[model samples]
Target: MSTSPPAGPTPEEMRDMLRAMTLIRRFEERASEEYMAGRIGGFLHLAIGEEAAIVGTVSALRPDDPLTSTYREHGQALARGTDPRAIMAELLGRATGICGGRGGSMHLMDRERSFYGGYGIVGGSVPLALGLAWASHYRGDDRVSVTMFGEGAANQGVVSECFNMAGLWDLPIVFLILNNQYGMGTPVERAAAVEDFYPRATAYDIESWKVDGMDVLAVRAAISEAARLAREERRPACVELLAYRYKGHSMSDPDTVRDAAEKERWKARDPLVTFERVLLGEGIMDASAIAQMQAEVDQVVDDATEFAKGSPEVPVDQLADQVYAQPWNDDPRGSALVNP
Candidate 1:
């Protein structure tokens, strides 16, 4: 007995994508509430309206694929199938977190799931993704590496350099630019010389295309094509997902709120709503099924929140643990090794 998907995604696949996107939306909304209530610390970025791009892109990748991402990674984490409870606990800096609470929200590293670090620095993960792809190529593993960054990081010179190398070596890496219009406080139009980020890959002779990030199926199809070019053709490429962020760059940006008209314009194409309408219109799922899906997602998110709330915080004595390769023990040798 063999199991392989048909030519393209099926009805069930679309439904699954919808479920994942909805899950991320609910999780982020709850996370925002938790952040306001003082349950989470440090910088917090939400992908409230960019769920489709995240879920669709991740679903396009294979199980063995490795992914590196920017600080706006809560949605990516869920899309990659990281336990929502563990992710919440990590945000709370609990001892039982995915990275033992040291990584916090921005550094959700799950080795088992092959989701690498959620890099805090803009454009920092690009070269790392290239390296991962190169390593996989060297080992003949045939796995791809996907590096996702915001439009702000696209301007970094290091990203261009990485682009050159990825194309030159024909590494199997897909550079995904999540263009939410505004990069932090500055709009991308004012920041980058080239607004057509996808075609910019042509400068390095890499295949590229722009994707309507508001549509999950379109985004998934674009990424699936990119992955095919990498897997079968042994090439590298780029994709610019044109979506909008529903929240400020971070929770601390009080002045980052956008004008109501602009906000409503983007919200009009809300990925979650559009996907629901498509499914209902096609008769793939009835209204009751969609409602049931929403109810199930709410329960999952509620359970995750309750789990994180009751989880234990990292102990004071273990604060210095995992800072070095060796454990922080009372022994002099361990102390010297860590210090040295």
Candidate 2:
């Protein structure tokens, strides 16, 4: 998808974008360090090089707007205003975590900030986001529901169904596609028919746009426009952000499938570095200011790591507590109603 009428962001907005990207970068770096130290359990996916897409799309949304994302969602949760400490705690599976030690790295949820739980199943959250948009529409609210997923999810049948319904109903939904070059070990060319995932929206008669995910300003502009269309025009739009992940599909993989030269090329375009350069070029932030910002973010992540480490683990007896919503019939008052 494409749009015109481009304008540069103000100095303050540029600085804020840089700060947000910095926080994400530092947080992920810390998470990696802690994971290696055996603090974080379960599978962990890091959004190392895709900082711009996460911060930019999130910066465009209203605070009350709901966001749903795939399993690689630490950046999404942080961008949606979940506390770093809480996210770190959740990753460590501590009792003070976001989901109270139940939903770990892949399933962080903070309903207070309108961040819906990150779905582990591929393409599962697409329809869930559609339902959220439907609810917003039915209640006559101007809220837009944004759903983030990888390029791999584009081929999922459920995604197409959600797209069809969102377009047909004119639902206020924005499908943010973070096309980070590779889906696990498979490249887009190998897994998908068309490399340009944005045009897939054309099949459903929805508006779409493609942006350079490495450029924070470009992502912000594209998402801002798409979100405005979704809210005011009650339309569904898709944004395809071309980016790459520096890490493997998960923390366990070595990410050695790609050529060393190709990895180096993408590393040179790191979103955090790109945004910092943009800020310096625009005179929005000096080297000292940037250093100070980095220091603050580093401190925050350090504190978060300490908090997660000090947090107590969930008791063994409560393992089955949150598995099901309703209380078990072990209570005598409810025994009489059992069919058996």
Candidate 3:
């Protein structure tokens, strides 16, 4: 958890990361406001604190490499280049949204970006990501598949099964375990038999390590190295990103005294603030430049909010659409696979 970052990013690279992390933070804050105001519905999970983990790892990927994520993925999507307006509209359940408003916050996806999903199930998407890695291996493409899940998911039998398959096939995959301490109020210590989760991968002989998830450079260094090994070596790896979420598990989880105190302790090392200090301490950015970057990020989130509000809602009659994959022929009803 305390490993040092590889050589720091250049000034411009640091500035870009600062801007991206700022965008994710601002977007989550605005999304929280919208959810409370009833502009968004259903379960709304925020990644206000884990931006560095999502952003840093994603920044290290190739554009075509496939990736899947857990429900708390607004930050992941934004960091990996998903359209903000589409993501916001999806949360609002509008027709203009990604997945045509069908997937909502937990299913934002874009095949073009290789972001396979915002999976709602705890570890449901692991096999899908593994399949992608297999596809790369099969085609000799060498693209690594990244699948992220919470610490609680590490306990799933299906997760273990997939680990077996990954090792058995020598698949180019990376399991990104985001250890935020609590799995919906259940502390990891209470849930996991082993507090240190990476060792679980050793059972399958996959490479594994832990990284300081709050530090973008460190997360990048560790994840990038893992990805490189996965890509070049055609093997699987695991990374335990030590991070914390400042908000509740979802909009429905009531805030408590203990939760508030925990947030403060973690906020003292807020990823954005910490990174900004590094920028300032190193003279990469002055106060004014930092403020201007934040101001710009605020505008981006504000614009996305307005776009979601203006987007059209999905029609009730079309509810049955997108329920199943369309058949080969023009008429799905006439296709043998569909008719059968």
Candidate 4:
């Protein structure tokens, strides 16, 4: 007798995943619009096409697991259940932001969600993840730290150091390389002598794998296993997600370098569209149901935008409020400005 094909996610779970991806897509689109309109300041990096990789990896994780990511990480915060309004406020530099508007787009953190931050430096967050893992290992806690960085950052000396330390100490962590086929405008083939990222983990004696970043299920499966190996075995693991970004490196780039035909090929496999097809063809949801879901996601994004617009700007006087160390007020050299 043949066992029935392994059960898939429940209808509710499937819908949640699809809805999460939709929310990210719409949120990023609206963010781009707001940036262009000058409502959002500073560098803005959009992950419009990497929702599957973001949501899938986050979904596979435990709530208490600490996470770190590169500058392109609004999707990570969203997937970790940070309120969209707060995130939008952060981007808009309003006091209601998650970081009280101090961090802006490149530095978002929600301690409650265990999302440490989205570091501005290329591989800055990787070592932070390693530190968290080391803490967990030292404390005998079962938390597995996860870090997401670009393939460009994969070459960073700090990242290699973290890999070596993790392997040598058997730290519980997962290093997720979001290989979007480009390091900014430069293609992967041009950036590195050995382009395949997962294999490089072997140099540090860490187990590794690669997953289709466009396929949510595949990403979830791979990361779930990687997370398990890290947490249970108390060792390091790595995964390279093959994905593509539809936009330029940042809002400022004209995005002229990539070929139109290459973009079209990736768009044809758009994560949201492919997943929608799966939901429909598999009878998990009907067109009307999917339409309702889309409408809801749109409203969520719209509400977020309005909340951001209405929020108050961060006061300049409170600039030093979050700093942990206070300097002397009596110094003639203006240490008073920091102390005050």
Considering every candidate listed, which one attains the maximal lDDT?
Answer: 4
Report the poorest 10 consecutive residues by lDDT, candidate 3.
1-10
Q: Which stretches of candidate 3 lie over 4 Å from their true place?
A: 1-8, 257-259, 325-340
Put down candidate 1 lDDT per residue, 159-195, tens digits, no spaces: 9998899989999999999999898778877898878
Q: What TM-score would each prediction reach against the true structure?
A: 0.94, 0.94, 0.92, 0.94
Estimate, for each residue in 285-337, the C-alpha lDDT of model 4 and write its tens digit. 99999999899999999999999999999776675567434442444676645
Query: Model 1 — TM-score against the truth?
Result: 0.94
Tens-place lDDT digits, model 2, residues 1-340: 4455545678887787788788888898888888899988998899999999999998888988999998888988888878999999999999989999888999999999999979899889999999999999999999999999999998899899998999899999999999997889898899998889888887898999788999998898899888988998899999999999999999998988988899999999888888888788878899999999889888988998899999999986675578654444555565524624
RMSD of each: 4.1, 3.0, 3.6, 3.4
- Where does candidate 2 stray beyond 4 Å? 1-8, 325-340
In model 3, pairs of residues that clash are: none
Candidate 1 Cα lDDT to native: 0.88
What lDDT does the true structure give each of the candidates?
A: 0.88, 0.88, 0.87, 0.90
Better of 2 and 4 by lDDT: 4
